[model samples]
Target: MERGLTGRYEVTRTAEEAVRAFVPNPLPPEPPLDLSGERQRLLEQALLACGRLDGVSALLPDPDLFLYAYVRREAVLSSQIEGTQSSLSDLLLFELDEAPGVPFDDVVEVSNYVAALEHGMNRLREGFPISNRLLREMHEKLLARGRGVDKLPGEFRQTQNWIGGTRPGNAHYVPPPPADLADCMASLERFIHSDPKPFPDLINAALTHVQFETIHPFLDGNGRVGRLLIALMLHDAKVLRQPLLYLSLYFKQHRAEYYRLLDRVRQEGDWEAWLEFFLEGVTQTAGGAVETAHRLLALFQEDRNRLQDLGRSAANTLRIFNALCSRPIATIRDLEATTGVSYPTASKAIETLSELGIVRELTGRQRDRVYAYDRYLALLNEGTEPL
Candidate 1:
């Protein structure tokens, strides 16, 4: 609708020079959003896809098994957008604590993402509201160790920050000045907790995402935390039963368009365009998650059937295989502890699976041998290649 510039810009001074920093208005865009016709159809499709994704838990023995791997996949992709080179295998290998020569800084950032995500979901599960306090908590965990440790992890920035250039004067975008950050975020919190919200939860989420990004609340880890906020918002609103919908892969795929729409919302008041893109991403990502679940279920069934064809040793072999499904990468010691089998039994079972081409040894060592559920990791690793 080209209502106008979404917010006012103020000339703020950086160390080098002066720049125009943006202060975005709160949620529920003025003159309202135009969700008629095509936008409405997109919204319905997105909600239906979300419903299907929520029901995918029915296909799994335990949803946490999928979530355990899926969340790490998300962490990898999200950190990649921030220029991290960590892959899914790197993350799994790190979690296994056998990371000898891995990319420590990149993998550390990705690992912190997993921890931050888990913290938010756990708090939500414990009936905590989605508020600034929760955002700060997640940010604290996000920068707990690696790269951005000195940037004040849990607190909002008290210094002006700019994006995409060498200095604020030449930066492509400048967020609100430090003095206005608190008011901007407080307005965002009110919109989140508002009863009888002005828009549907899906639309509300899309709007909140843009607002949060524009605010650039944290000095570092703003991009990662903003992505996490989407999953957190939808789950808290009861829009999804689980935190299964992630847009990191989608945003990473259509990154140029994602940035363009964010700019349009700020420059021309084009909320409709951004809503359509965000809604399409929700539908596409949710559908992909459900499809992945089905494929994993089928893979387990097919492999188990193959094991059943064997004779007396099938019982114990199947036991270790079940444990492998939960932790696709593990040491024989890990498999032994998880399945309560002897070291010899665990070794023998893994050897049997290796003969069947189901498991591959990661480290060719006499001791501390690690095995991978080859096909399973391949399935989860799709679209997670680091940029």
Candidate 2:
């Protein structure tokens, strides 16, 4: 299925020199994707994994408790792919306004990702269509703070942009010129809202992801925005009850291969190869999420069982413990406000959990100590090691 140079390139003049910027052909690549045999098997496996992930949502006693931490984990991993060194703990620490040694720019970028994602999910839940407008809104939140604040947050690039090079003249891949960006994105919008989609939702997501990367819509944060689109698309199509199937970990694991496949789709019309890779990512990531959910559930139960052994203090400790399950990292004041316990009770409960090794103090200060649910954070920290 070599469609020979997937899109036409036009020579454009950059301030440095003349460069050939590529304008990609609209969605539904020509000679349609070959979905027979192995591809079909992969698709089925991905769908089955998704079904299991959807089932996981219903099984959790409080899915939001899991989502609260899981989404932050995703935020860390996703921003890590974009060269941010912000770890999950850095984000949690930043959220509490106690960021000391953490990189402010990196943590702020990651925090913005969390906010952007929350905004997108909320809008989707409010029955908003996944269109260019929503993408802009999410993009606005994404670059609203820190380093990317100057990158034209919510708007498409009005100037040429390139990827991986010193300048546009020597860039690895130059996206379409500014003049063509609007039309390119509009075409993408139509495909998103197409009445009879040419491909199934998952397949469409894979296709849309590649197209978004190719288009390179925004001046900055294109990579993060494109990845966010995948979760939004899956949730919109009802593939998952929650926005849980994040491919950042998988993509981060297979970084080179992921980029190579995206290039192959444009260089050679090898949609099947990319589709296979995307499906594997879907299945692997979804399955990993389900396993994480189960582990969290078991850990919750095991810790709750331990709380029962607290004797007379178990009743009050349980309230604080439940609150920690959602926040994982909290100040005594936060614990008091959330659990509605007095400051003394909150302090005593956290001290008890610290003795039990269920929670550990993040800051050594005796006055404004912050506690971390150590085991819980460790579970979510898996595979999020900085690159």
Candidate 3:
């Protein structure tokens, strides 16, 4: 077993003790209710907007703003948990492969975090069980690039880590010692695999998230990995098809209250209050994501129509435009491969877009120039940073 920071304490807690320790205090007294009429109407509006996003012929509003915000939020949340500092601007440039002065390793970590999230979501879509094996796979991906970290990649921690402080010596909360970790993890695995007491999916998510945090299973990447598990569980429960909902913003916004709620759950068994908080987060975050998706779809449609109006080569233009949605930055080489056009033809199509003010040259150099879907990126970045 690994030692604590002072080397004076060893981790030890039974799985049952661990669960009892982290459960919210003052368990909520009431069950979660269906959305009220007004809230239901709002959800319907959000769904309608999302539907427009899915429809091929629907007009799209500026979606890049929302995309940018979502991407930034993910970066910030994932990085914060791992103690990596990155700004929205830094994340934006990193995503574009234009970030300067940032270490390549840091960029790789961020990318891997995003990829893990996407992978988990895709697996959920295929209806795979959120097994311990799956969690290990994700953990492995998270730590695959670290140089010398002793915490085994893709495995539960055999050591102890603390939360809410710079060092374990000074941490506000010291989780169960390492000796107890195995039992704690086993109990969690049981919860995931078997139905326990009846609970709403949202409540189950909150309980699972809290328990994972308490377990702090991995020596590193526990916070990010735990949060990712929340999204995975939500999808597995059929709450959403995409890993689009994020609670980071809510937690970030209510940082103190978030922790307090968790503490209260453990101290008072207040599962009811915690469940309410979680459901509100769900309803709010989902509503916002739906809005963003609609906005993005609208922007895409408008751009498509603009290209159509230009009377550009219909097939070539559509191909290039759709490619930009997936890849905001592109080179002539990229276009040629994506469109199956000769280099010269690809260059011509790019020139046509440039002439029509649809694409902008991101790199001023004439040779091996890079073009950007500036508006699209901008839309994706919106509300991602503090105003």
Candidate 4:
């Protein structure tokens, strides 16, 4: 066994030992990857479900609206894993104006994290190769604002890190020592950019995720970082046009099972079962996202038609409505910034929308009042229920 230290904590490991030695047994059954005949049919059905989500997402009046919503959802989910109580609505409402007790700076950091992920996704869409540098950049964006003291933002671990538990003293698994960090990172880089072997992209994603988790490269934010890698890798592999499939909800819901399955792979080389769980997560999460997108689109179209019937100014109404779609909460300042209108014009647009019942005032304060795209936030929140 190899022994090392991170500060005062001790980490011990061996090359041939179980990947997660502290995790117990009774691993789940391995799943099969051969999607021939009936299996192939199931795979097609899952892809079709994902396609429907993309179609519905395309119906948004402004694609940036959906993109913004996605960023909030990603932040909320990533925060949840770390025991942060922020919700999808919290993120949306905070964007309009800072909330009491909630750190505005942290919110900005989270927004940038989401933006970095979106930027990475865009690069991947344009066929850019995934690199260690890209992952570090994303991590830096994610941890830009220090969450608390002693946790440096955006920097990698100078000491060793572990998984399966919170503190090093209580960790269930200690990965390769710092002396082996180079080999561990090289393995991860190979997994990311290397040619695909016999495994399907989804299966490969699950394996890569486990490997990254095992590596535990960062001091904090490993869980969130690992999840982000899943979305990016899937986009890079062309499995989805957008980084829309978020499995954190799935992982959080089945926390024990998730960890168990991951440990099973390292202990028993049980790739099949992990692949099945991942594929199932994709199918279910994709379906939920599709439903949510459809509902949001329907709501948008209905509201647009309503405004048109009222003989509203098409250009201004469309601009305000589109801004609300992207950001569920908005202020006159936001409307002015988005629509490039005078403050008075922006106020008039918001008042008109409020009168039309398309937007509702969230806060009663006269100055810097917040307006909510209730329907849009509802649809986005529907898919994200805390476990």
Candidate 5:
């Protein structure tokens, strides 16, 4: 299965230095993927996991509550891979207009990711094609604020870029130079449109992700954007009702191996190895998401049942509890606004929940107190212990 070099490299001169910039061949590599035996088994497992995840979403009373929090968790983890130090809690705190203890720039990066992802998924749901234009739109939102603002946010890079080194001289890999971008990107666009032949959705996504990484279209946020493309493709193909299958956690956990496999595809024509890894990631990530959704659903039901024991306070207590299910952490003011109840009423309800050990107060203060849904947050915070 070793077909070799996958694509040709161009000898380009940048800043009085010569470098070999890789221009990857388009999708549906010659001699097709070897989907026999183990590879076929992995593909089947991934499809089954995705099917199970889809079932979970369909059965949920409100999938958006899970989607809302899950997407933000992905944003935090995806940006973490790009060296951002923000955590999922930090993102929630930031969304609530509270200061996240992390650096302002780091939180902004994660926040932008959330916005960018939402934009892409919304556009796709509206019947927009996943082409270069949509990617540009996503890139615009991704670097809309903070550190990446100066990195030519929406447009493809017009200058040479390198990865893993100070300059092209010692860079780990140099992407296609500026002059070759148009042809390179156009070929990529055709592949995305499934010009000649169409691969299955999961296989198409795996191929597209690697090609985008090699293309490294934007000046910055290539890695983040490439990862986003996976969710977008899956959703577009109707593989999942919600954008719930994120592989960033798996990729981040296996960081070194992930990069190595990507390189292996380019250097050696080892698509089978990378495909195997990707399938495993998809299966593991999808199964994990299904488990988390079920656990969260069960926890919410159990806690709601427990709240029913609040007797006279049960009616008002249930209202606040529902708000916490959506926002896991809330201040009295948050519950008040969300539940449309008065301040004193919200406070008493929170006090009742706290007494019942349903909600835990985080800040030890007499005023401006904040409360967390305790076990609910614990379930979401699993595997998200920050980098």
Candidate 6:
């Protein structure tokens, strides 16, 4: 049902032109979401997928190994939507201080994404609530050392900001003017912390994500932070044990439709359409994550079997293989530190793996060479091409 224009637009003057900036209403869309028939089925599937995704940790001997790469994969995909060009390998190489020709700023943005997500997860584990304060903290880490550093990292925008065009006059969307931010954000927080709980966890997350994006609270990292809010909210609400569900790939894949639905919710008051898309993304992404965990577990076991035949050299070689499982890209020194072996032992293990074709050298250089677990990365690199 089209409820028509979800919020009022306020006329605001900017440097070059005047525009009607949108200030969105708070959560629990008026008239309530119609979650009765097919919508109910979608929500049930999404929640069930999340339940399986939450228990996917059981599929791995060490879930962090998958989490480590999976999170970076998400960072790359998320940043790519904002026009960053860094790949998963580029990020891993950057963390090792060995990405000689990789785009520095792009990789920094992806790395900061990893750090920001970890910070948010850590804060949640320490009993912090998801509020404006924590969102600011995550935004701070996200822009700590990227192109947006000058855009005021940890604070909400104090000036008008628009999306898509050269100026607010012709922009695709203009978020709320600065003056409305405090009240808007506080209302959003209240919705999140409502005593009776306005909606179920999955529904609440969908509503919160849209409201936060409409608010567009931050100066530079709103898109990234808004995407992060979904994962954070799901994890905080006990929908998932690990902060693993990311819709960036889904949004990136269906870029046009995603934007259209967000606009529809604002203009036609079609919350049901947006919620349908959001639930589908959750179901697809969560199920995909579980499938990935299974594939990785199988890959690890297959690779271990391949190495078990190495006999005398298998001991040290398997140790390095374990390290590679956690980090698919590593230098000799990185493996050494991770495996607690001497430089020579790590180097020889690398040499043996090189001969076996289990790992390949990234750089042909005699020194500062990097190696990659090619097949493992191949799995994570799916659908991560820059948009």
| Model 6 weakest 10-residue run by lDDT | 94-103
Q: lDDT tens string, model 6, 146-232?
A: 698998989998889888998999999999999999999999999999878877898998988889999998889888999999999
> Which tens-of-lDDT digit does each residue in 80-138 have in candidate 3?
54555554445545665675235666656766677677666667667777877778778
Clashes (backbone N, CA, C under 3 Å), per candidate, total 0, 0, 43, 4, 0, 0
Root-mean-square deviation of each candidate, in angstroms?
1.0, 0.9, 7.2, 5.9, 1.3, 1.2
- TM-score per model over all chains: 0.98, 0.99, 0.76, 0.82, 0.97, 0.98
Candidate 2 similarity to native, TM-score:
0.99
Which one wins on lDDT?
1
Q: TM-score of model 4 relative to the true fold?
A: 0.82
State the lDDT at 238 in candidate 6: 86
Q: Of 2 and 6, which scores higher on TM-score? A: 2
lDDT for 348 (candidate 2): 87
Rank candidates, lDDT, best first. Answer: 1, 2, 6, 5, 4, 3
> Candidate 4: global Cα-lDDT?
0.68
Error of 2 at 285 (Å): 0.3
lDDT of 4 by residue, 136-206 (tens): 77777776664622455555566656665665545676655666656666666765565545456666677
lDDT of 5 by residue, 1-387 (tens): 787998899998888999999988877788788899998899999999999999999999998999988998899899999999998778887887878889999999999999999999989878999989899999999999999999999999999999999999789999998988888888887887875447778998999999999999899999999999999999988888788999999999999999999899998888889999999999999999999999998898988898887678789989989999999888999899999989998999998888889899777889888788889877877887677
Regions of candidate 5 where Cα sits further than 4 Å from its true position: 195-197
Q: What local distance difference test score does each model get? A: 0.92, 0.92, 0.63, 0.68, 0.90, 0.91
Cα lDDT of model 1 by residue, 339-374, tens digit: 999999989999999999999998888889889999
lDDT of 1: 0.92
Count of backbone collisions within predicted model 6: 0
